[model samples]
Target: MKRKAPSNPVTQTQKQLSLEDDKVKALFNQKIWDPKFQDELKDEIANAKPYNWGTIHDLVDDDLLRAVRKEIETEIHFTKKETDIYKVNQSGDLANLSGLDWNDLSRLPNMYKLRQILYSEKYRDFFGYVTGAGKLSASKTDMSVNTYTKGCHLLTHDDVIGSRRISFILYLPDPDRKWKSHYGGGLRLFPSIKENIPYTDPCAKLVPQFNQIAFFKVQPGFSFHDVEEVRVDKHRLSIQGWYHIPQKGEDGYIPGEEEAWIDQNISTLAQLESRTLQDFEFPNAEREILPFHQTKHYERLLTGEEDNNKDCKFLSEALKLTEREIQYLSQYISPEHLTAEGITKLQKSFEDNSSLQIESFLNDPKSDLLKKLIKHDELNKECPMEAKDVKAPWKTATPSHKWRYLYMDGKSHEYFATEEDMLENLNNEEPSNFKWLKETLINAKTSNNDNELEIALVDLAQFLKSLIFKKYIATLTLLCPLAEKVIIRRFRPGKDFTLATKCNLSEVLKGVEGFVDAVLEATLCLTPSNGWTSGEVGGYELYMADETIDEEEKDDTQYERDVEDATVYRRDDAGDSVLINKPASWNSLNLVLRDESVMEFVKYISWGAESSRWDVRIQWDVKSMESDV
Candidate 1:
């Protein structure tokens, strides 16, 4: 008994692993730990511009990695998940690596060994030294394997989830083939506008290669990144993980610091979300109230006293209605909003805050007809999922991550997917505006566009373009001084939405300045049915206060422009929203006075929607007289 002695379990396990797998011997390049290499790598990372990041090629043992990949491909089950921000296939969190039965270990032997090596104290020290992230917890290993195939993507986000100190991804694409940038699924890093608000485009990109590792310290607001949509038919497999701060009882553990970091990180999201809504969404509450002085000014206009004294023609001039025009308008507009008292109430609301919602906007007869047509088109017409197949005067909105819909802009005669095609179409047209609707409809009515496939939808678009409809819009918004851009939009179930975005001062309309601070926008929703009352199926219109900071604030050197900086307004109610969440409704008109910072969007229509969210969207770059008068 004394001769055998007690077998050392840990030593026996290591011996068994060494005997079974020679591939594990080359898991990490030993040169990474050499004194000279470590010093150089630290310097390179510390001095890196834009952001601190590093990449290593041939980071893993080839045979072992290939075996892990094979095991994943064959044994792992993936679920496809989609959101407004991302669409990707993901496997369950690799919890099995931590606790495996004998049979499971036998099957996933390579994966088990890989996990052991990655979390080992030796590798932890190396990673900690290189990233300068301090002590990483061996106990808290968070990792998941993902396969991004065609059309898979992830929109911009900073990986600042709780306790995450460093973020890394190890690529396992085809070892024999080169993964090119054109094939698309590259990791893109975005530059910040101030802090937390990332620019629309990426400033840096990393096209991953097989057996390569990419990593960076997880900075809350600064580490914005995304995976570009996979354009070609191929698989991009990778293991994504985070190294967290050491927990209590672990080496280098600091008391109360992790909690403080998590609290600060969570607060960043809360602060940004509020500011984001205000800067980009609609119906800004901060400026929603009509000042008493503006109300008095508006009252003078309504009472006809201001017009007599100052030659200020308000609704009368805005409407520009002759007897013939009134007759045509009467066909579409309900009598409720046509009266003097009704006009006064609307004027007061509009003058006060520049926003109004008129229920029963259209006359009963017209509403009934329009609703029937929309329902019939939705039920009968074949909706194209691909942007190219969409017909025009309707064109499919491209770069689906931002917005996707069949929109009748009344400019393009055919579908245009690329920005170049859209710009060309705009330039070729006589007027670079949606006022082209009238002309487009006239042409469509007279000549048969042989390529046009969906006739019913075209007819519906023609209705939205009719002079009668425009007159009704003019009566409500009083935005007739400026040229209008009208669009009939159809957000198909499951595939359509507009991401939150603010209205910009269009370069085309820069010369038409001296207007109001806010842009006038309106939407007439006609969903045909009552199913959208709850907003459960999406298609709700959302608006929030503007989040833009003062120009001087940005220039302030002392202002901390990081996620931790709570420079803007901070409240417990940061994420609380003020919205005009009218789900798809028949004959409901929503008009908004939107500043450039006010964000707005039609939420994505879920597959569960009863039908499409049909709307006649309108915009005007109006100059508010109140600004000067």
Candidate 2:
């Protein structure tokens, strides 16, 4: 008989590397397997406030974890990434183990062992039992390492995507030291105002220590959370992973279960786009159509009908501010921006780039007074930190997942608790009027009181709403405005932001004459303090191309899943997609004509910021002036 073929050395080594049951058990804290301890954890998870979640300290073997950290520090490469939602140093997914051979595994033996044992049947069962997430798939290993140094953060979002069953994070900060609450990298959870709306503030927070594991079942609408920005210069290292639903051949596998689950739970992006939820959102993406009379006025001006000079050649000449108009505007706007030459230059620049940044946009007297008032308020006054505490004329933008900031829309504060309430408010809404605002501005200019900041901001908002200012904008952009909204906004330090979102155009304007299918957006930045030049403390406004493919054309399941999980799509820094990244500044103006294909967001302000980012944000429903000209 031929001698038996010698067993392959590599095959034998692979078999040896397959973690034994007893060895895997030894890699974790012994309490994990104790029946009493397991029951206690289950009870704790069930009783947790805000949401069902649990944590275990010293979950992994100390020596093994230390070795794993050592391997990671030596072998792993991290890239610093900044997006609207987060800024962190990240390594490639740790789930690439299936592609590695024994040689690669040998180099990271401890890491390999940790991944194996964590996903091993024994530990997964314990995890499933405590969190009540049911069966988890061992075949789907999803994990990545992240280091959040100073200024890094992950904003508010619910982890609801694909077949994920549970979310977890294992801390690996310096083992010898304690991670204090003040360090500001805690995992904070928010209570839901209703099924799909999270409260503006977090109700619970978990500050993780080395060798600790925090986890919770993935509750689509209810489980909203965020990572507080790291305030100090220290590396807060952690491994974030997810346990997905069972796959075919697994014990709890059920055909179409994942599909059913996905159908039942809509992603955050889908929720944001839901037509039914629009009314629930404050500062809704709705523009009041310019009254017919106002629209006709602008149209005639553009057509030179106002001057009865149909022979006018350039758009700048047709829409130019008269000397009298310029003198009136000189009270608020910079004189330099009102000159004939200035208007021509602005129109040329805007025509070439479809964007412009005008510095010293406000006249010096107004700018200086406003800056002094804002800076004084920042240094002395106490800002309202809760939604209920926000004073009238200043309302907090709500439905936390989409955006949160203080805005003055010159309307009485109203909170809609139901659909009926929203409908009533809409039906009763009156046409725009600036009589009260004009009177308030007069009183504010002469008043010597603490409300000067509010008064000044309101005065600017009123000025922006004026037809004269609209004419100035028309000249600069060569676009006639059909409708508009002017909002005085304050992005509070450590609390406020607007997430990445695209312009929501009204269906009524779809086929209207001269419609350009774009929004003429402008932000007059009036941040008061210094030290924001680097954008390290957040408060930067970013505009990017909406690179999402049309749903009907997508064929890749993984790409579809990533799109559902909005964070994953935005996590990578795709330099080419970014159109603008303007940091918080003083007395500057940014104008971008945005279409449906562009998305924009204001980065979350860090607690380290010297003051809030104050600005007058304006949007105009614009139409082409070519036909009128």
- The sequence of per-residue lDDT tens digits that candidate 2 reaches over residues 1-629 is 22232222236766677788899899899999999999998999999989999899999999999998888888888778777777888775432333346666778888878888988898999999999887899777666778889888887888877788898999999889999999999999989867777887889999979999989888988888989888888889988888889878788999999989988998777777677557667776788786556555565543334433454454546576788878878999888888878878988999998999999999999999999999898888888877767765577787788888988777644544333344457555444444565455456554344576777787788788888888888878878877788888999988888878788776776565667788999999999888887887888888899887566665434453333222535633358888988889999999999998898989889888999999999999887775546
Which regions in candidate 2 have their CA more than 4 angstroms from the true location?
Answer: 1-15, 93-100, 294-296, 299-318, 414-449, 549-557, 560-568, 571-574
- How high is the lDDT of residue 360 in model 1? 94
**TM-score, one value per model:** 0.53, 0.90
lDDT tens readout by residue for model 1, 110-200? 8777887877777788888987887998776666778888767665567766677888888999989999988888988766544554544
Q: What is the C-alpha lDDT of each candidate?
A: 0.63, 0.79
RMSD of 1: 12.9
Query: How many steric clashes does model 2 contain?
Result: 0
**lDDT of candidate 2 at residue 521, scale 0 to 100:** 95
Clashes, model 1: 14
How far residue 290's Cα lies from its native spot in candidate 1, in Å, is 8.2
